[model samples]
Target chain A: MLEATIDASLLKDSIESLSVLVDEARVHISPEGIGVKAVDPANVAMVSFELQADAFDEYQAEESEIGLDLTRVLDILGVAEKTDKVKMKLEEDSRKLSISIGGISYTLTLLDPSTIRAEPRIPQLELPAEIVVNGKGFSRTIKAAEKISDHMSMGVEGETFFLEAEGDTDRMRQEMPRDELISITPGPARSLFSLDYLSDIAKPASKSNEVTLQIGNDFPIKINFEIAGGRGKVGYLLAPRIESE
Target chain B: MLEATIDASLLKDSIESLSVLVDEARVHISPEGIGVKAVDPANVAMVSFELQADAFDEYQAEESEIGLDLTRVLDILGVAEKTDKVKMKLEEDSRKLSISIGGISYTLTLLDPSTIRAEPRIPQLELPAEIVVNGKGFSRTIKAAEKISDHMSMGVEGETFFLEAEGDTDRMRQEMPRDELISITPGPARSLFSLDYLSDIAKPASKSNEVTLQIGNDFPIKINFEIAGGRGKVGYLLAPRIESE
Candidate 1:
């Protein structure tokens, strides 16, 4: 028997927001972390997510640490009567997770954790430029980029940051002045990435006004947001488009 | 000239939520009453929504109406810089709506208002049975029903209410005892409907914990949710599925 308590609504909202961009059917869960990885059906985009066990109120598993289908758990959690507290219990068989909230109880079956595979990490590179801005500002910028094109090119110069997207039908650009930004430290950086992925990862960041972003030329961008004074980091690796001659 | 002021975040959030279930390309807007309507591609579901002028700090129009490609408006609204106030301006000649918030400005072109068709209302429904329950609870119940079957049968006996779905591979049922119900006033009848339609209409209800449902024998079910304390209504009209002999 195992038990843990958390703000049911908070966790549920977070999962719902994230699951929109990633599949919940196959998620990786471990004592150290919980994550998901799926490539877009078009094979052009890949999404990977990881949540450290520290994110949990009580992370415990005696011997059976496993992956579970997040879709079912999210479904059960979605129906949970919203209340201040949510309690989770693991039965002896370890095949089901029982959730209780506001006097309502729901039992959700788990899938074989072994079926989920770990996402391969891309090689790390030294990002050239990093900037810190309000999380809300970053989200706004990406959203604007989305209107012009599905892909966007970003770069930093001195104190100015820029996002540019141009398509056959539309062109959009957003430039943020250095003074308006929380912090802008220029370094080596210029990259083009999928705006859709950036928008999805920026969701949690939208909750807060402030966030920090690390950018590198043709490398993964790291966006960090503060939750309860701690940090939640979303690292996005976008492959550069190869121009056909 | 048209201008309106609202809590930038609230309007943004509400519209975003509505956009998920609505196709952005074709949505009709009317000033006769502040409302929007759109028929789903399949014509099986029609979403009717109205937000009272009170929800806005300033609502003014010169008896003018317009139809907009919701995608453009939503895109602009989604990117509005977070500020206390959002300002909107409409230009007649250019046929563009300009939005400004937190010093950022966006312009979206409007579609020909004439092309937008208003949703026709079925003669006032004389629903026989009506029940009130936690809005969130009802949404969850329907979600569960969706998990088991595409069509759900809803019925009431005295005070007891039931939702049942049976498929070749799965069957799900949810029962609410009359005693546990918030309010149950028996009227004319029971009905079966497409779970898909119910789920779409139940979205706004999730914001509130209470909802009212009206059912008539083998007739369309009407679900109503209050927005801004009865000032606004979001309703749905879903055709009933005929059972085969």
Candidate 2:
């Protein structure tokens, strides 16, 4: 059972982060916080999200697991203003999520959690390079790369972090030296990633001031960023796409 | 031959106004100005647009009649900044329109004028009801109506001007009394129009302070708005849908 009120924008942000990877998710709600761990259908990406109880204006819940359709919730939130407080409660009888904004109420049927894909284990990784930069700047670079190619290479060589994409005739490269980045633990690390996953991953962090990236050669990258003024955290793990020489 | 240089935003606005109704149009470029008159495919609406030479930073023409595809021009302008100056010149050899904005050069092949639908005669009718209101307000009402229905009624009753849309189970109505309206010449007139046309025609005027609407019972409504400041004028005539009682 869960009944809480949070900023419409924060909830929308959280849902968007989850929707980018999985359409349906089994959300774990406890007095401590809320969590969603899901892997995309293609198994190329995994999303791990947690929002502390303090993130909500009013939060009270018993430990419960509910299956949610991210897209449906997102649509309801779409009509809400960023500053509006969205109250959500799980209806006991119908097992539906009731969302109330002003006078409007949206009831979403809880899906059967057993129908959702099995949760994936969080992979332990010790990436050699770490880069911290403005999330919006990184997102923009991803978009520019999208205009030219479908894949981009992320690497750190010495003190510079580089994002490069090559099309048949056009190539795009964005470099942020140590001075330009928030922080960089640079090394010789390179990994290619599909823009399809990279672009959507940027949605939740687009407004963030800083984003952390942990990368390794030909390995998955771990992206972590804070939400709701550090009251919430979202981590994305995207498997790298190998590039043929 | 035609040559002109204009602010990227101004040209984009003008094209967006006409593009809302017709895809291809015959653009008449004369020494004094540029004009486009065309009708939508369904013959439900007609758009007439004109920009005086004053609208351009530099203008020169030889009364050329060339066919243009608004969608293509709009695509090129999509990449330009608001302050960028777009220089357009008719290629002498290829008969293509060469659009140059900084380093980007887009050559759009001109369609044969004869291939486009014949220009329609501007219908002359005196509409009794005139209501001037914020274009954005009207546009927003149309968008909100679209969320519930495909058709809406526009009318003037006493000192109030109203737009009402009714769905099977929902209804939305927006009224602007004389005090709220910029100006009003109240008359007993009501007309039902398709949101498909009304929504798009409001694009160019969405940000404008004032939009002039002329309506008569079961007759075509004339929407007049200024674009590119006062240097350009756009008029749209939309046939009203007769309400089946």
Candidate 3:
């Protein structure tokens, strides 16, 4: 059983972050907050999300697990104003969640948590480099790379962080020096990742003021950012695609 | 021989007004101005467009007729900033138009004028009722009507002008009294038009501050508006659909 009231945009953005990685998620509701851990069907990317109880105007929940169809909820929230307050409640014996916003109310059938893929354990990584950059700049760089190739390389050399993409006939590169970046802890970190996953991650990360990226040579990259006015947090882990000789 | 310089947006909007009805058009370029009259493939709608010489920053031309692929020109103009100045030139012996905008230049091949359909002769119509309405409000009404049916009815009743549509299961109507409209001339003028044509015409009409609509009982409707800061004018004539008993 759970009940909560949150800002429409806050809830929408949070759900959007998760939806970019997975269509359906197993949401864990606790007294403190809501959490979701899921991996893409290809197992190439994983997403971890958390929304604090303080993010909501009012919140109450028992420890419970439920499956949610993110797309369906997004469609319903499409009409809501950013300033709207969305109310959601689920009774102990009810299999449907009641959602109300302004003059409209929707009864959303809840998916069974058991039917979803079990949450995967997030692996620990101690990357040698970390960079913080404005989300818009990062998103722009990813878009530029997309025009050149299907894969892009990210690395730190000296005090500069660079993203480069190469196609058979075209190549593009964007360099962000320490002065341009919010911050950078430079190290010998260079990795090539598929633009497919980075492009998807860029959608949610672009809304953030600061996005943290940690990378290692020939290893997976870790991206973290805060949302919902820093009351919620999201992290993405994308495995790098090995370069072909 | 022809050479002209004009605002990017003005040229784009002018071509857009004609492109909506026909993909290729025989454009008549005169020392005084440019004109195009074309009918849609279905021959149910006609467009008459004119861009005065005064609309261009620099204009010079000999009497000429050229066939232009509207879509191709629009695509080239898509990258231009609205404030950019577009320069166009055609040599007496050349079949290509040299277009320059900002730092980019494109040589667009001109279609043979003889290959395109002959310019249509615009029929004269003296409608009994005339209505002047805000372009935005008119566009909104057409959109709402689209949601309900494939066609809509427009007519003036007493002092009120009404736009309405009815589908098998839904209906929508919008009424604008004289106080709400710029002006309205009431008459026994009511006709139904295919939304397919009106919706396309609405694209350019929606950009004008005021659009004059002339209608007559069971007759085609006439729509006229100005563009390019009033230096350009466009007119449309749509054959009315017969309502079966």
Q: Pick the candidate with the highest lDDT.
A: 3
lDDT (tens digit, per residue) of candidate 2 on A1-245: 88999989889988999999988999988998899999999999999999999999999888888888787677556656668898889877536777766434455668878888867899999999999989999999999999999999999988999999999999999888999999999876899999999999987778889999999899899999999899999999999999978
Candidate 2 pairs with clashing backbones: none
lDDT, candidate 3, B39-108, per-residue tens:
9999999999999999999999999999898987786677567798999898576477777765344566
lDDT of 1 at B1: 53
DockQ, model 2, C-alpha based: 0.04
- Residue pairs with colliding backbones in model 3 are none
Q: Please state the CAPRI-style docking class of candidate 2.
A: incorrect
TM-score on alpha carbons, each prediction: 0.55, 0.55, 0.55
Error at A219, model 2, angstroms: 35
Decide which is better by lDDT, 2 or 3: 3
Q: Model 1, A69-130: lDDT tens per residue?
A: 55666777766656557777778887787887778887877666566444445456567787
Error of 1 at B119 (Å): 3.0
DockQ of every predicted complex: 0.13, 0.04, 0.04
Query: Which regions of candidate 3 deviate over 4 angstroms?
Result: B1-245
